[model samples]
Target: MSRLLLVVLLLANVGTAIGVVYARHLHRQSFIELARLEKTRDELNIEFGRLQLEQATVAESNRIDAIARTRLGMKFPEASDVVVIQP
Candidate 1:
């Protein structure tokens, strides 16, 4: 009876060791994946910031108005040139 109890205890210890090793391996893999994902996220964030700056520079309303006034010779009409059109 004593020998049987010893055998059971030994088997339990072996099972526990195997479970601990597997858990450690899983944790290591998860950390590596997390690092890779974080790197990708950072790169995307940089690209997004650059695009935002480019959009602001390209679509400036004040610049468009300046170009229209200086280059196109367009002007706002005076009260005489204003036509009263009603539908």
Candidate 2:
């Protein structure tokens, strides 16, 4: 009976050790995955900033006015063409 009890205790200790190793492996894997995600997030943030700058440059009023004048041949109305109506 005493030997049987010793064998059970030894088996339990081995099982616990195996569990500890598996837990450590999972912790390492999670750490590596977190680092990879953080790097991807930083790269996306940089790309977002660049896109915002490009959008601002493209939406400038001066650039739009230049395009309108050159491409569409749009011009401001002359004073003689202005008609004032008193209502």
Candidate 3:
């Protein structure tokens, strides 16, 4: 009976050790996954900032005016060319 009790205790100890190992492995996997997602989020944020800057540069009035003058041959006329028509 004493030997049987010793065998049961040993089995229980082995089971507990296996549980600890499995839990540790899962914890490590989750930590790695979290780090990967954080890196992706940071990269996306940087890209978003660059896109915002590009939008601002493209939307400037000075840039549009320059393009119109150079590419489309648009010009502001003299005061004498202005005519106001009243209905």
Candidate 4:
């Protein structure tokens, strides 16, 4: 009976050690994945900032006016061309 109890205890200890090893492996894998995701998030944030800057540049009033004049042949009205009416 004593030998049987010892065998059972040894088996339980081995099983617990295997569980610990698996848990450690999972933790390491999770840490690596977290690092990868954080790197991707940082890269995307940089790209988003660049895109926001480009959008701001494109949306500036002077840039719009230049494009209108150069590409669309638009022009501001001269004083003689102005017509005012009471609304």
Q: Using lDDT, give the best candidate's number.
A: 4
Task: Indicate the worst ten consecutive residues by lDDT in candidate 2.
Answer: 74-83
**What's the distance in Å from true for residue 11, model 3?**
1.6
Candidate 4 lDDT, 1-87, residue by residue in tens: 999999999999999999999999999999999999999999999999999999999999999999999999999999999999999
lDDT of 1 by residue, 14-73 (tens): 999999999999999999999999999999999999999999987898887888899998
Which candidate wins on TM-score? Answer: 4
Against the hidden reference, what TM-scores do the models get?
A: 0.74, 0.81, 0.76, 0.87
User: Candidate 1: lDDT over CA atoms?
Assistant: 0.95
Show the colliding residue pairs in model 3. none
Candidate RMSDs in Å, in order, are 2.8, 2.2, 2.7, 1.7
**Candidate 2: what lDDT?**
0.98
Candidate 1: where are CA atoms >4 Å away?
62-84
| Cα-based lDDT at residue 15, candidate 1 | 97
The sequence of per-residue lDDT tens digits that candidate 2 reaches over residues 36-86 is 999999999999999999999999999999999999999889999899999
Which 10 residues in a row give candidate 1 its minimum summed lDDT? 58-67
- lDDT for predicted candidate 3 compared with the true structure: 0.99
TM-score of 4: 0.87
Backbone clashes, candidate 2: 0
Can you tell me which runs of candidate 3 are displaced by over 4 Å?
A: 76-87
Rank by lDDT (best first): 4, 3, 2, 1
Off by over 4 Å in 4: 79-87
lDDT of each: 0.95, 0.98, 0.99, 0.99
